[model samples]
Target: MNITVKLFATFRAGRFDIESRTYAEGTTVGDVVRELNLSEKELGIMLVNSRHVKLDHRLEEGDTLSLFPLLGGG
Candidate 1:
């Protein structure tokens, strides 16, 4: 299965063009993040098909997912 991912902030450092990636079927958002060697704190937000989703959210083929970093302002 394939999924489109949009990386933001620190996550964008290693990649370009918020492109699509291929993964095994039944993979969850959390699985990919870990496989990518990213930490939970680095995954500030997870959006699935335009809605906020938890790490447990299972991904489907062709699903669009976005990951954002934690924002802090005083």
Candidate 2:
């Protein structure tokens, strides 16, 4: 199965450009997040198909996943 992956902010700056990944069915968002070695502090929002989803959410083929960094500034 294949899913689209999108990275924003520092994540993109980190050179995580593959944009997508192919994994076996039943793969969870947390699985991919861990594979990328991204820490919770580096991850802001997670969306699947435009809906906010949790790390444990199961990903399906053709799912579009977007990751963003936490915005911080005074």
- Clash totals, every prediction: 0, 0
lDDT of 1 by residue, 1-74 (tens): 99998888888887754888999999999997887777798668889989999999999999998988888768
Instruction: Report residue 62 deviation for candidate 1 (angstroms).
Output: 0.6
Candidate 1 matches the true fold with a TM-score of 0.89
- Cα lDDT of model 2 by residue, 1-74, tens digit: 89999888788776665476898899998898888777887778999999999999999999998988898789
Find the candidate with the highest TM-score and give its number.
Answer: 1
- Distance from true position, residue 18, model 2, in Å? 5.7
Global lDDT of each model?
Answer: 0.86, 0.86
Output the lDDT of residue 60, model 1: 99
Q: How high is each candidate's TM-score?
A: 0.89, 0.88
